[model samples]
Target: MQKKTIAVGNSSFIALIEDQHYYVDKTACFKPLLDSGNFIDLITRPRRFGKTLFMDSLRLFLAINPANPGSTAKQERLFNGLKVREDKNFCDKYMGQVPVLFLSLKGVEGSSFEAAYRALVQKIVDAAKMHAYLLDSPRLDEEDKKLLREYQSRDFMRDLANIDYASSFLKNMLFFLARHFDRQAMLFLDEYDVPLAKAASRGYYNAMCDFVRAFFDTLKPEAGLVLNDRPVLKKAVLTGCLRVSKESIFTGVNNFSINTICSDNVSLSACMGFTESDVLALLDYYGLSSRKQDVKHWYDGYRFGSNDIYSPWDVLNFCQCALSSKNPLEFKPDNYWIGTSSNDVIDEFLGFLTEEDAERMQTLIDGGSIELQINDELNHSDIRRHQSEDFWTLLLFTGYLTIAKHAGYKKYLLRIPNEEIRNTFRSRVQVRFSVENRSFAAHGLKLAEAATRGDVGGMAKVLEPLLKNYVSVRDTATKAPAENYYHGFLSALFACAGNRINDFQSNAESGYGFADIVFSSGYGTDRLGIVIEIKRTARPEELLDAVDNALKQIDEKNYAECLRRMRCRKYYAYGIAFCGKNCEVGGGTLREV
Candidate 1:
């Protein structure tokens, strides 16, 4: 693979140009969105899926329009010969037509609610000042200017009284700029839901919602009137991970239209990042076609609509890793997506999860679907139900997930989209639930002994506790605990074994059937293989019968196909039976041939 030329993060502009990493062309994704002459369309996407970059590209495009004599035509040079320019009609119709108001609500990591609200307002004011400059309006009188300066000088606490009216100030600013510019203003608000998310996690959601409602109220009716009169106020485009519903913020704004992940009118999916062709080109460029399957399995399954998509951030990061490592396996996945958001929210949610919820979570993890409601209210108290096949759907819609499929909805399946998200979720789950140490140490030790000595009885003894503690009774209407319980036991055993006896895998397919567990010793010298079978028996004699049945199945199914393929000299197989917490272990009783 060739050396990578781009770094992935919010600091792409600074790093992409300065660093020597090769960057792929992602400008094509934004072409249709930018070229289309739509106004007031909101695009919602999951976090770290390139929402910020899309907005940044738009900002760059509009700031450099050639129609405005004062605009920096030189800045327009950055986009010359790009995909947007390919559409001659769009370029002529929309290019350089109006001034753009781009603002991001992402930097509100305040120490307190009041402080954060103040900081958020200040960001708007700062952006407004840029608009003021662009409009060059003398609408502010001397007294008004003095008041604005005085308001800016006060501390957050001292300014709290006037903070309730901060929206009016911003509204007035937008109105003044529209009148001054003599053209409709296009507002691009990026990460518009940050404050709500921050407040929700902090238990200050009410305050944040109130502030936002007031803030948005200033933009509507009043701003609409100004735009109607001035013709300069064109449209607004808001992008965020979550769409705070109108009922939640702009309660009475009947003119508003929301283009969310579910919206069919807006093709926002393509705007956020590259498609499959983009990834193939990059992979081909790097001469890493040999690892194409691995790349697809690990990072290639995000779909946002009718089109299959990949997270641009993950693709870039993968490219950078492949370029640096001759072996793709050496590349460590980073949880870039989850790292972008505050962990407190996810941690809190996980902490409150009930056992039933955890079981449901497993189903979601195992590609099962569940119904969830989307509330349009401020508090998310109302529920609008939708069927989702996996947790990936919930994760993507809630910013924890991303598009893994783009065909019709039936073809989509969501996983932890990239290395970044997988790592983040792993870390959060560990931190939040690691304290609940269920006593599996004794069981783990016995299981290890059984594997070492090929003692089926010892294995049964250890697995008995697992069956009692983890498995649900048949009376319960739960899905069969095949993969979930087995995997859990394996993980617990590995953890308790002090990481010494590694190289364990389960569900190895054989000619006749599949083996439940096949654990091998990590040490090359003390080689061992152990096969385990689990059963629920009605009587003590049934335990022996279960063992006999397992042994027959093992041979009939050719469970040793893999071992035979490797030409191993000797192999160990054990059969185990469980009746609730009780178990019996014994050797395989070969059939008399």
Candidate 2:
């Protein structure tokens, strides 16, 4: 049994098959797609959810060899042993029998409208070159061949005047292929909305939207015609992260069907992501079955149309690390999904948070949920308006949040999907709110003053109010203990406090053990040092006991060793215990080192 290689970032179906990379069979999605009556299908999922792979696989499965039309041998070998191979009759009807045009808009992004338009034209020319054999067809006249030849040349692609025909490039290509094969072509466009998304972020949204609208005009029924008055487009599938409204770019295409994460279409639900069984089998194949719980905790909470799915990107990267490690079991789960993109969506979303919205954000980070109306079809322009409805909708569709449960008509209880996403939210929340620390600087200063004076009760009073208002990380039994959450909160608080606090260190070395927090402040003989230990209690009744034990630990471990080096005449060692938003603080008597 040879080990199968994991394709970390590869999306090429043919290459993956030829190279024998481990793959989860999503070919079963083909049967439903064929049975679907819609002329154009738009499937939306978050980025890095295997949308590109699925589209590329579909392209090879249906595409005929343009140079050698009688070649099913190549297609057959590529799909061998996959689930779609089991459907012999269906495969015989459709496989290797049609001209397929596949285009990806993932790279069609730019800082300006002109730049983005040029990129799109390049994409059109690239797709045209894929089926260059159409130039040799006897059914096509010299004029059609001349047009394709122009499309293949570098001069036509670089001509700024050709921008006018950019929207119709694919349409003309479909016509040329249809005239040659005497069969309508199927179109598969991947990352269809990337240009609009990039344009919106770069402030050229309207210009890009108009261009996309014209490009989508090719999907209209009237535009799908060839020389013999036959429809050139038999079926089309477009993949993107969001469903831009029909009024925005996809105007008047009645046959356009959408399958989003929230849609009830069960067929495409498991296609874009890996199901539990898919992940389990992958783990077992690599002898990492013991890591099932860790994998599920970090990557598995996405609910796509009533089916639980794990991010395929996260799963593959995790498996790659485990397989390369000497001790797979000791490998800890990581936030693999965060590095896939710029995470600008989360940043833009946090920028619009009102104080009221901040409370809702707190709820989500604390392992709870917030209810809101989710609009699956949102225009790019709406995001510019900073509409709360649009922001929440974007968050849900972009994978920052998932539906815990459907509430009323369009309302949903949305929450952070898993530990990986939750961690992202917590870190972002800390950064976003810390910028507005001036709002609570008074409380932070009071807490600092209390800590310097050994006033434990006063410190608790200051933190209690701040805790009630601030966003908190999840503190469930399955998660890292709440102590870490409190530690970050206090660290941020002390950092923002006035000049009274200095040389702050968190979880730094002390006497015989690591101290949760150590700092020195004041000057000359009035210079003082402080050491703090933090704890979280399961029940409120144990708050005082937890505080007592924390103080005892500090004393036993001589946490004041760092303060002694700081040359402080005296120091205070305080113990803090938090139970939910409430807390208890106690400290040993101030003493000379």
Candidate 3:
């Protein structure tokens, strides 16, 4: 494979440049659409998934007919030997008979729905004028001529009241063009839900939803009149990230079909870019076979239904890096997917944190699943009702989290995609969790450090302060329960010190039952394991009994099986009993056996 210049930031360049290898032949995606001859279809795919490139490919293929009036002879040369060239039926029936109204809604990010809706309509109107220029027909009725002039004027608000009504203006314009050309008008909408995502995240979901609902209403059956010998509206293909389910936004559209990530009808994965064979061949040409598995691990888990999809954006970036560098690992890790959204939205969602939620989050961090119940109507108004799974789903769809697996039907278990997300989440959680319990964290840190070093005196010094300040309260009204404080203190300790010296497991399965805290660390040539038992009382005899019970459980359950499997030179299990933060270390004596 020859090294091709990967084009960036230019939509036109992606479609027309084949000699320079700037274009990948994804014309295979047009097969189903062209075969079925559907007038309108909506496709929902994540951002940077080649929606723009696919639309541009369609534009080039349609720009070649004499009936279309803008047939550039040079543009016809661009599609030679492409997938569409082999389709005899497509060439005869649809190659150049219709005029296409192509528009992208990707650039309309706004502070509110009204502002964004206005910007979106302006873009569509501008696209209409550009198409009109391509048509170059001076002959028109007064009403058609007026519509064209009004479109050029760009005061779409006067022509249409709301975003929904705005689509009527577009439909009318397309209707007129089809009649003028004596052909059906084909509509290709790219990144159509961008405005909706922006508005929903910026506090205008309902307004945005209403606008989109009205906009799509124009495509309803018998909504517009046919003009000249042309069909008023012939076909449309709309693509975006979220499906915005018809029950949610697009109502009353009886003939439309949705091509989504989970759709059985569309092979959206291969529609975007290169196939697996293409990737392997490229790797072999570039001598990157060794790094192929690593690349797949990071970017290959995206599943569009059962057909696993790879991010075309990442694949391109990787190819560019491979061509430019001798070192295959030179590409820097980046959260490229999440960079499209504002950080404030992520921060705002993280702001609603509680201690219980923190504990649950820790379990998830350690590879546990969280269940979230979904309701009938899921909208921005009920955003706060979102459970952990809802937030995880949002993160997954938005690219913060990647779907690890589909657990049954609707349940999607999620995990951080790469080290970038993992590290970012870890830092954010540390700051938030530490802010509310600075002093407690400090005290717990001291105790954990001493326990790691096996210094009984140093541990007592820290334990005394915790008992006095937090655990010494006898009146239930004045303080939290002793058990609650113990759990919290242990959690803070594990969080702050576990990464450094101790391997602690909270609510992890042990021999007979789950253990509260099992701290293990290695010394010069030996290993030490401590099983901590927390209770409400600190009597000497009671402490001894608790310690004996913990040791017996450890023996019964083979809790040290992990250490033994690792073939440690030595091991010891110490049981420490705690009451209201005060603890005494007494357990079965350390023996070589």
Q: Best candidate, lDDT-wise?
A: 2
Best by TM-score: 2
The worst-scoring run of ten residues by lDDT in candidate 3 lies at: 372-381
Model 3 vs. true fold: TM:
0.64
- lDDT by residue (226-261, candidate 3, tens digit) is 665444777878887665666766666666777655
In candidate 1, which residue ranges exceed 4 Å CA deviation?
1-4, 11-39, 64-72, 128-158, 222-228, 326-340, 351-356, 367-394, 399-593
Backbone collision tally, model 2: 0
Q: Which residue runs of candidate 2 sit more than 4 Å off their true CA positions?
A: 434-593
The lDDT per prediction is: 0.57, 0.83, 0.60
**TM-score of each candidate structure, all chains considered together:** 0.62, 0.73, 0.64
Which stretches of model 3 miss by more than 4 angstroms? 13-21, 37-39, 64-75, 134-139, 155-167, 228-231, 284-287, 326-335, 338-340, 343-346, 351-385, 401-407, 413-593
Error of 2 at 546 (Å): 57
